[model samples]
Target chain A: MGKPKKLLNNPVDVVTELIDGLTAACGGDLRRLDGRNAVVRTEIADGKVALLIGGGSGHEPMFPGFVGPNLADGAPCGEVFAAPTPDLILDTLSAVDRGRGVLMVYGNYAGDNMNFDIAAELAEEVGIVTRTVRVWDDVAAAPLDRITDRRGIAGDFFVIKVAGGAAAELSDLDEVYRVAVKARDNTRSMGVALAAGSIPETGERTFELPEDEIEIGMGAHGEPGIARRKITDADAIAEEMTDRILADLPFSAGDEVALLVNNLGATTCMEMLIVARKVHHVLKARGIAVHRTDVGSFLTCQEMAGLSITLMKLDGELKRYLDMPARSFAYSRA
Target chain B: MGKPKKLLNNPVDVVTELIDGLTAACGGDLRRLDGRNAVVRTEIADGKVALLIGGGSGHEPMFPGFVGPNLADGAPCGEVFAAPTPDLILDTLSAVDRGRGVLMVYGNYAGDNMNFDIAAELAEEVGIVTRTVRVWDDVAAAPLDRITDRRGIAGDFFVIKVAGGAAAELSDLDEVYRVAVKARDNTRSMGVALAAGSIPETGERTFELPEDEIEIGMGAHGEPGIARRKITDADAIAEEMTDRILADLPFSAGDEVALLVNNLGATTCMEMLIVARKVHHVLKARGIAVHRTDVGSFLTCQEMAGLSITLMKLDGELKRYLDMPARSFAYSRA
Candidate 1:
């Protein structure tokens, strides 16, 4: 296994160093919890349900950059490719929680489930209300009948955005959870990895891949996907991903959607724009309307070169929420 | 030389297809002039001096995606790693002119100079007033006496932003050009490249880089730089780049500025944030206050793995322009 050369100091300290760097660049919009691997919004708005989201770090803009107003109130960061512990989650929860209770959101993963579940129990013991919403939108992870068996991937962004927007619009915990469910249920995603993302700590690769080949449907963490094959045209890859996502959720003709051409890690924006061209053709041919499109590195593995295509079936409510004004170090809308 | 595998179709037509993809995904905010390799704002602001920027096309989000309100009025795209022809620039200038005149901006490349200079003469022949601003802020490219000999890299973003903001705020072409020149003069940048970005057309590497080594002060186009050595710690690399850039522009203590930690191409956001942390520390230790910091891929070279640090000294006017609200397919602020 070849480890991609990295510019890091003390591989074991990569995550801590990453957060320290992130908070400093953000000025005062973000802050770290004392002695904990977590971060919270510096100015928590009153009378709103706190939306908490987390997972393994490495997906830069996703887990931490998503912490701001109209987004996740706080995020408990885990080590690269590892989930946070219950205690870490509790720290962020306590710091961000106001009188409005809390809603926890994350992708479907074993470590994440166990840690978050334990933290929810801990929160209950402390008498703070908590609700959970797990994302299972990666159709390639499981059959339609076993949807919950699917692992969460980049589709978490759409769900989180809706959840954040809902939280900002209302104070009721159940209402926020309901819209979050709606967003998660309507979303679907699939990806193809042309290269593996390496972890700096172990100087190890997450998976092995042959040059001139690609793995279709690879997860964000480099987990097993549907198939691997010789490298082919980008249009074919985009078609494969779009067809799978559209069919699983049955996002058919006349349906409106917010399209996401997310770079898994190191795919260039130029390549992504090409992929978006094909995706647009695919959706247009089916009479679907693309309400909006986001093309950039939203979620990522560490320097993995590939991308994911996500479609969020949008309604009047979801569209309004998606268009709401939001700003962060990673993403913003004017 | 290793050709990093890419996801593109009909490599020769990549640029045209990229323009097609970008305009399509943008959902009507941007459009291409019929029968030309140029992109323009869907609705140009009337009576405003047109801001035109162009360069090679491989630097995604720079030449085309930057075309929108409060930014470049239009951008003529050249082939990958090549400059656009004067005819292409003429086509854009002809279409975007609104009586106020045109101001063209681009990196300090020889080919770009000839083409843009020719276009300026042609614009005069057609009775449309025109001015030009060439960016030369790469510290490693030249010594102080030969500052204009430096190649422009990610610093183009800051110059274009200030130019666009000025164009939107004032009706005078010379004033817009003056602010752009000031912005260009105040900015300084330096970068390090770990890997080379390959061209899809020939599947050939731009330059060779040994494993376990990096080239400090590398230009975005893989141009030769100051030194190449074994990979070192992030802090040391940041210090080398910061010291060179700060000294070149004399960004002394108590100076305020906007700092840009730009990814060259395939460098992940995780690596960039780590670099940002070190950069922030270096500036703080020198008593320099970072007014703002942007960490992401604002400009890139295919899939090159490395990054550049850009600092633009901000005066009251420059800061005002820097803070102006602008949104494009690739960048935005809420």
Candidate 2:
């Protein structure tokens, strides 16, 4: 269709402009790093183990939107679908670092991993201790034997939620990192794409499919999915997605978990909720107990149409941290 | 495009299934009313002036998602884009009504107004007292002299927020009604539609427009708008929308207000944020102070592609209630 319509100006400046709008929406709770495409909390406590979250920009409310009270201490943003540069990440690292070290959490894309690692080395050179936990929760991206190869998806929210709480309460950065790793390890996600979203700069669709087909296990940024088939009802989709996630984690009977049915971008809340209903049904039949359920748009691929289901197997510590109060531009708990 | 893709089973059953899923996501904070397509808070306080909000089902998270602490006590749902029946509304009213009274707040659509009013009268016959506050916030829907004819849009959230807070805090039903009326009067909103969403049962688009054109002031259900024009950038659109809302409410330079940039489904967060930045810029230039700003999908028209800007001029009492903590399925403040 004639170049996917977008309400934007100077699309090359979308990342910066969106950051401006995001900070404005925050109402002074967050401020951008001067001359850098990054944001940090306005008031971080001294000696607090900082939690730093960052990623490419198109996924609104993921990295930048998550920076707030009881969430990430800061977020260094990259251009759309591109990882942040090492220098920008280092600058944000220094800004959010208190007397205690900072812990970096992000998706396990190669570009992000490399940039964040480089920044961590630079921070070490500056005597700022830091640890890293790359989230690889998308089971569709790789086999369980090579879990690190999987890409992070909506499960980033679960990892960030637990890590933010741990960073806030635990003085030691290592302890916070440990909890974040646990969160990442316990989470699993898989997505399907009914349609493609366009890029702001080019105004071109990211990918294309037939009118009545859907791609299962598709990555957020138009990566090829594991399977492409004709569109089906929500129950079958939900059952298949939940089955994959459950098998990956082997979430067995009586295992309480937090479930997330995240809208990829354009999927309506109605569709997500319908999927959520079937997912709950499937989980119930499998004898798994859902501790909590979240259904909304946490991470998105521009205006892409589809959704992903994420489940995080929770224990006592994870449940305590997950249930803590948080206030952010995108997510909040009370 | 090939009968607009939808993740649904038995579209006629969508309303009930979605409510089931919504209550599941609520984690025991909300439960459905027996034998009715409605939901109520599990533990509304004794002798409280209850708040009941409802409308059609397509605009999800509005009627159902907004039910929680410091929000509506219950919401009787209608089918997609259709008003709830009088019997269902009366049933929900009885379920949520405490001894004090019940306050009903909803959009000012013809069907909704008729149904809710009928229900209110029925409740009166049953020895229960109820008051109504119809939200007529769409400036494009009617002339200033005929304000009551305007259709409510995203401004429903602002009115509901104030009314919910007032109902919770005020012991007298008349005082709560006064506050809700004030909220409805102070709020104004306008929406522009880039594309249309489909009906679940028919799988047919609600309306159609040329690829390069947009309809300004279109209703959520594809009602005629004030103007149809070629696509434009965010700044021009935001300026025009903000100007209309400001002049309609006659918002003054010294007035303080809350700004909401709501997504009308399928529009990317980046676009919404860009619009928010320009709206803020426009307001700043006009010397209007924004007390708070919220940007997200509060109310949607099933996967419709567009956005709406809402302004609610605030007084001291309005500001206090607006800032109070609230938790719900779709919205939560901490």
B56 Cα displacement, candidate 1 (Å):
0.6
How much does candidate 1 score in TM-score? 0.99
**Candidate that scores best on DockQ:** 2
The TM-score obtained for chain B by all candidates, in the order given, is: 0.98, 0.99
**If you assessed candidate 1 against the hidden native complex, which CAPRI class would it receive?**
high
Candidate DockQ scores, in order? 0.81, 0.86
TM-score of each: 0.99, 0.99
Across residues B24-88, which tens digit of lDDT does each residue of candidate 2 receive? 89979999999579999999999999999999999887889999888899999999999999999
Off by more than 4 A, model 1? none
Model 1: how far residue B155 lies from native, Å: 0.6
DockQ of candidate 1 compared with the true complex: 0.81
Error at A18, model 2, angstroms? 0.4
Per-residue lDDT, model 2, residue A15, is 93
